[model samples]
Target chain A: MSAMTHEEVRELLAAHVMELLLPEERASVVAHLAGCAECAREVESLRATSAELALAAPDRSFDARRCNGVRSRLLARTAADRDARARLAAGQLPEREPLSLRPPHATAPESAGGWRTASMVLAASVAGLILFGGSILVQSRRELAQARESESQRQRLIAGLIGPGVRLIELAPTERRPGSARMFWNQTLGAWTFLAYDLAIPAEGRTYQIWLITPDDRRISAGIFTPSADGNAIATTTYALAADSLTAVAVTEEPAGGVDAPSGDIVLLGAAR
Target chain B: MIADVRSPDDADALVTRVAGGDEHALGVLYDRWSPLVFSVCVHILGDDDEAEEAVEETFWQAWRQAERYDVTRGAVATWLTTIARSRALDRLRASRRRQEETMSHLSETKRAAVDATTRRGDDPARSAEVAERRVLVRQALLALPLEQREVLELAYFRGLSQTEIAEHTGQPLGTVKTRVRLAMEKLRDRLGILRERDA
Candidate 1:
């Protein structure tokens, strides 16, 4: 080993490729390769194998973090499939069509407010992910749905008409809480259609209620409602909403049967406005 | 005791480690074979997005499907390279891309990012060569008459259903069928002749 030239040693280093040689093999490989030229040739061949094992990895900055997000969402969506379908059918929160992914470069940040509004709609739309469980090869199908384009939303000034005497209300965001509903007097629909958007999903087994105002100004009952997937509540007569008794639409915590109205502390207050 | 994983023993140990969720061991496997995989994906599917997407899906799929990976059939690297290649082919088909057309514009951006990263790492040119070599392999693959190469590329790299490949290539369907069985026979013959010459 001591007699070997540096170049010969370097060649054998190929056979024994590494950052540093181990203590046991270090003395032996170094000893023979010092004098033997053919043994040295073998080392060069060995070196190629090590060189072939380069250590580059994919960039981990963005996609690695995104992978964790994908996994959690995949698990949650798969588990909650049943509840999602039930709610969609109950309230008829219109099912959105699949949207194709636009090239990221096609669109750029222009205005802040427009994006903020659009993103809110986008966030709700993406909640329904396509199933990609283990039936097929382990590939996933977690797609995002797009909110209907704004032009379509704006052009469609859709109106709902209740019975001759119906209660209609608008839910606005309040300083303390996000949800607040106010009744509107639309003589066309008689009964009120509660338009609540700022409200988040109510607690399990509980719902928001609408109340009618009697001529004496005493609060009467309208109907109870469960929130849609997007957390907006609509007044449905399937349960208890009757023809017009003009008052206000106040959402109160109610049991399954519901109260005569205005009994619970009002979560939303939509008076004729 | 080994510097390179070239033996049966080494392959077995690595598989054991992989099955145990050893990501570093997975890294070791990746370091050893990513070039083969990346090359194959780029070759079969011209688009970089589909290739990278295929590779990512392939690695994750391999991780989840580790229990099923068998060692008797072929080398682990070959198995993995095959997986990535298959996914890339599937993506290419899904996108309905022609043999030369790229499906994702984002892939070009990714290549730029890789080039920049490599330059910062020192031998940026060598890093670029690694990418170039894959393109060359693709060019070589494309040079083969559309008949045999399509079968070989699809059967070997893309992992298409034979029927599916038959449908896409629009060959006699039976002509597509024989091409794969014959192409593999030719690949083996070429490898055998090379081995004999080396001997």
Candidate 2:
């Protein structure tokens, strides 16, 4: 489209701020404002005035209970979003997905074999004499199961770190806090492996929350963790987002369970390449 | 919980804290501004439930984007009302689209009448400061010429484009655009003085 003349663009500023312009016209106005400081300033002034028009709406009181309900629900939603992100970061898949870390081939056959072995043992043992052995077997099986799960988590973390499309984001210490952190985002696998070092432990009832900053500057909670006594921490989780969605990563000190949104001092921040 | 209303500086400080991830500051900002935001939503959406949802979305966006707010450009109230209006308008347009699809046979006049039926009752229990601000804005709007005021209201409250406003009011599109500009300029001049006095 041909560019609007300066006088024509000035006439559109009022409608521009009110969002009454057509898409093409709005685009023209935006294009003009980028090069014309005077028009931009006028638009800002008009926008402020237009916002006041909202105050002219009839004054009405909401039921206090209902108003409070909205507040409670909103805050709760934020906290829930944080928790969900924390869960994702922790590698706890959502309920709809399978949660077992064990390979598909290892699960059913292993359980079936265990049952078969238990039946054989039951047949071979004198009932009262087998009690002690049964307890020992159970204890051994539990330990083995835990070891298997730990190894699986380790393998997954390693896989995420070395996966294709993995990018490293280094977070430098914010002025208010001293800490350095790095995040390995595996775009292809939707996994995040975050490691932080040289950080002071938070105060009682406080933890550090990690955030993923999107291109539009929205901060999405990644997860929350407390560092070890020596100020080192690692967290791993899988969240499938578009490859180019994240623009940066940050860490902030938040209350122990984490709030819905970031509301603490930024401890570390790094822009994504 | 309802707290005593604070000065604009305090409001700005709350926004600053909110930018730093301060939940308490967000809560305080909500307590202070939800009424005005709700009032705008209710006026546009005309349903308590939807207006309440809009209010929630407005503050949620505020909490998420507080860092983007530039205090040199506008007050917190203006920043919030802008968000509130945008969200409410989104819902309004969505619902209108749905209504148009399902109620396509309804006459335009009947639909307009239905739109006008959303009752706007005054609440006498509002805070004095909020009540005063409302009166000032209303007075500024009332001072505009009727034709100019009509176009502004059509655009602001109805979310109409200039072409749409012209179609709705049966005036030339240029005339509608000129009226919108004149009306907004007058409001800026009138409310600009009030803002300076408050500052």
Please provide, for model 2 over A1-273, each residue's C-alpha lDDT reduced to its tens digit, 9 standing for 90 to 100.
789999999998999999988899999999999999888878877877788787677766876755765665455444434433455576552312112121111111212111111000110011111112111111232343444443234334443455236799999997966678888886654567777777898999998888877776667667777776657666666665577878998889999877667899888999999
lDDT by residue (B1-199, candidate 1, tens digit) is 1212223456556766767656556555554545555544655565554555555566656655677776543346545755665577578667755445333533442343233223222222123433343233333333445566555444443444556556655667557655654443343333232233225
- Where does candidate 2 chain B have its weakest 10-residue lDDT segment? B101-110
lDDT of 2 at A154: 37
Candidate 1 lands at a TM-score of 0.34
Query: fnat, candidate 1?
Result: 0.00
Candidate 2 ranges with C-alpha deviation above 4 Å: A84-273, B1-7, B101-130, B193-199
Q: Give the C-alpha interface root-mean-square deviation per candidate.
A: 14.5, 4.6
Clashing residue pairs found in predicted model 2? A78-A260, A79-A260, A89-A237, A262-B21, A263-B21, A263-B22
- CA lDDT for candidate 2: 0.68
